[model samples]
Target: MAKMRACRACHYLTTENMCPNCKSTNLSTSYTGIVVVLPGRKKGEDPRKGSYVASRLNIEKPGKYALKVR
Candidate 1:
């Protein structure tokens, strides 16, 4: 199986050429770590503000995210 590609803009990982999360074509294969954000759990609180991992990655919405996209 091939590794998932991470979006450069949102760090969202996907197998498709176009990122489903940010709809960005800028994707990279060089990424490290993965984060799955659960819905209805951390509602109202911005992941880019409250959560340490999400904050560091600048993730605003709840979804699968790459810890580091390079």
Candidate 2:
């Protein structure tokens, strides 16, 4: 498996050079904790609105994310 890097801008985890979440180039291999946000059951419903972690982290989409990125 390809090692995942954390996005410094949005904390999203990706394997690419740029962050697909925020389109930021600043990525870090040093990060702690992982959170997986799932999409809402209904279409057009945002999981962020209902998820405590997502709301606290200000995540706009559902995906794997890092708790902290250095």
Candidate 3:
């Protein structure tokens, strides 16, 4: 498996030299906590509508994001 790097700017994880989400080259190999946002919702509940972490992190796009980037 390839090592995944997390972008410092957007906190998006990728295996390339740059982040595909925000096109940021400032990536870090050392990071902690990973959050995966699902694209679907169960029943009538919205997934990201009032998510505490998502809103606090300022994540609009649904995908894998690092909680802390170093």
lDDT of 2 by residue, 1-70 (tens): 9999999999999999999989999999999999999988887677778999999999878999999888
lDDT by residue for model 3 (13-50), tens: 88999999899899999999998865546554444575
Model 1 misplaced stretches (Cα beyond 4 Å): 42-50
lDDT of 2 at 60: 79
Give the best candidate by TM-score: 2
Model 3 alpha-carbon drift over 4 Å, by segment: 40-50
lDDT (CA) per prediction: 0.82, 0.93, 0.83
Clashing pairs in 3: none
lDDT of 2 at 25: 96
TM-score per candidate: 0.73, 0.93, 0.81
Candidate 2 lDDT (Cα, whole model)? 0.93
What lDDT score is found at residue 47 in candidate 1? 65
Overall local distance difference test of candidate 1:
0.82
What's the number of clashes in each of the models? 0, 0, 0
